[model samples]
Target: MGSGTIVEVSDLFQNQPARLSFQRRPVTEMAKIVDIVMQHALSHPNVAFSLTNSGRIVFDVPSVSEYDDRLFDVLGTQASGLIPLSVPSEDENAPGDERWTGWISSPDITRGKGDEVHLFINQRPIASQPFQGAIRRGYKTRLMQGRHPIAILSLKIPPHEVDVNVHPTKRDVRLKHSWRVLERLERAIAHTLHSVATAPDSNASSLGIESIKETKTETETETYKKPSWAITATQQLTLSGDSARSLEPEKKRPISSSPAIQKTIFGGKPIAPALSSDERDIHRYSGIESERPDSEKPLSEIINELPEMEPLAQLADSYILVQSGEELLIVDQHALHERIRYERLKEDQNQWKPQSRISSISIELNPKEMSQLQAVSSTIKSFGFDFDIDSQSMIIHSAPAILTTSSIEDFMRDLLQDLSEDNQRALSMEKIKDEMAFMRACRGAVKANDKLSIAEMRRLLEDMRCIPNPWACVHGRPTAMRLTIHSLDHHFGRHG
Candidate 1:
């Protein structure tokens, strides 16, 4: 027999004509190979690894004692920003059998895709949803939606307690007690991140927000002031049961369009003059029809349709508290605004015209993102986004009036991801527009912790009431929660 049982196979899939016909892009295939090799190499730290690309050494990893050393070698400068994670013996009940260790990137050091998350079980690289979800749960509110943290996780579980041959590619593993393991991993990551925040290091501030020096450009410094009108004061309401209280309408001055004020009303959304009625009707025949015939109905009519409620007060600068009949309504200001914006975008899309040319904005895209954008460039242009693709960048010559420059990149990235996933390339014209509108609404809506005045808050509530589906946001999340007076009394010892 040949030494080491050397073997070579040629004419791959020769007998399978169907499989040979479906050819994957070279870059895509290479990326999968790189990912697989990286996963195996990261787990097997004792084994040295080298990657060659077209006769050139692209990446090299030397054998090392500690896992973090390999991470540093692979990620290079990027690894310096990561926080080391370890579980204390007291915190881990099965420390000997189910050992865990890893390094997690800080919130600022994030990726647009989940490719950076490399998880291994018992020194075997595997992809486990529970593991990924657990890591995400650990980060919780620290990361923004659509952003993924770069992490390297190693779980040393007993071989008999896990099953590895379930998946076709053996990429996943099933643990005997997965829920408990996931929970432990999540807790460990959270605690590690917390410790990093409180480590008294100059690199990170409290709450794990990065402490870095930022250079502000002229465009960043220039403030765009949006003029907002306040609504007439609503009826005052009283809170009963625990402690009786009455809210008085507070008079506030005209708000300046400070960064804080603009961020409060809408995050990164540009303030532009309203489009004319004729302008809005340009896309009427493009499969998008107005949801209501009375689209131009008076604002007062919409407000009148809402239940007779008294605005009580604002909660945590994010929620509006209102008293209606015997129920107390807790409205999420952000979600409510998102629903309103989504409806408005829908209306705008129906009237969108191919000839409409908004100001052009240059957006920088990475190689992979750029390729994805190029793939669906024509589809995007049909939605009123006229862009010219360049190497690692895109120049938009025309776009919808509602899209903000700062948020255009994020919007496009999210759109490209949806279109590129699973090779589902065929999409209807209306569906594309709808997806774009949803992304725009999500990005432009007011974020949490944005302070709003009593009048502005009341106007927002009235606006939300006008939407077709005011109960839920665009993402199907509940916009408000109602607590009945009886329910409140039952919670306490008074009614029971």
Candidate 2:
């Protein structure tokens, strides 16, 4: 009968020595316990929480209205950088079982390891890849490779809709609509981060940056001042009524000016004499010179040739800035390069032919690793990996065309680990090959913060525009974003 429930285990695994033997060291066990306590405390700030180690108090937090205070107490003073995340209230159309709330760190706050992230479901701490991926997808490109953002995500779902008994540790759960949850979480985090990025920072705005103010006229219509950078993309247009009207010219041409022109006429107006055969041919082929063939044309020419897009400056050495017509385009150099590489790989795959004489390489594996390899051996063979396995080790005779000698071992190991985790699904050779291509693209692609010349940046932009899926990389990360004049005007209060 107390308000709180207490769980205790006595003579744990006494009947199962194997289970006890598999337990981690005491120090590691203690760390896990502390992690569980910290997660629960952080998830439920309304409850007074305390943790102790060997009769000594580690942390104590009284009940508080704000979770930020509790976070500081648990995660140390550095937790101040974490941004409070609030998902929009579920709409009437939203599933009643779906609920998510969390706090995400700013782009400035990150960790080399993903341990900084804590996920909870129904006030219970969970360790699920889908949940973790949701957080990563939310942070998206704001964080760099190998660096994960700090987050504390809390989720709630209807009991009937979730299967919590899927994992022995109760960390993994099966959601009836897992994709919906992930999509919602990602959208909420992205919206918050976007708002923070676009919002004027107090310190920066106070440092002599001119502030744009919105004004209302007698007609109650909101008006904004024109942005200073409006002319940066192209020649500035004067909105003067007379000048604007004068720019438009009337079109009048004689029907017989060309033989083709004579084909269409409203009335029997005076038609000029038909041109000579040579002249008619000349006129017929006049505009043909402008039509560029796809094979011979450059990428810029293929994409309508954005002559007005003058290269401005690169941002953070990662995003290339170019003025396109009246819009500013920010292109992610790494993502752009990755997409290019992936497309090249795809093209190569289409033209791929099996090798006549495949070379062999020997691979050594421990017993555990060997077992893992055997489990996925058939899948590996289907992926163009010709190999022979024995009790102790395995020898690879041929490898995938996409993989190199140096990376093959690591690639095989990773694939084995993945297969060990998910054995039920039949592995698709195409999927495996695509993943290989993705890895190669990631490794060979340009990295962030890498300097580039103006010509190089322009070339990359041109290539991106020519690609079918130029907006995102192979991994679905955004490669470029266009900031329009309207958005800029709105941001700078230059609207009417």
Model 1, residue 167: distance off in Å is: 3.7
* lDDT tens per residue, model 1, 1-496: 2233233667878898789667676544544455566777788888877766578554467789987788766655557778888674455554336777888887765555675677888788887555777787777545545567778888887889899888888886778877667767776776676555522222222111121212223221111111111113563321111123344545453656588644543445533334332222211111111122123322444633567666689876667898878988888776777677777777764435544445666766533455556556777877677778764468877666554444455456556666655566576767766755764554445655466667666677667667788887776766787777866666444564
TM-scores for all candidates: the values are: 0.53, 0.40
Which residue pairs clash within candidate 2? 224-495, 225-494
List clashing residue pairs in candidate 1. 280-351
RMSD of each candidate relative to the true structure: 16.0, 20.3
Model 1, global lDDT: 0.60
TM-score quality measure for candidate 2 = 0.40
**lDDT of model 2 at position 83:** 79
Kindly report which residue stretches of model 2 are placed more than 4 angstroms away from their true locations once superposed: 1-14, 88-97, 198-496
Deviation from native of the Cα of residue 460 in model 1, angstroms: 5.4
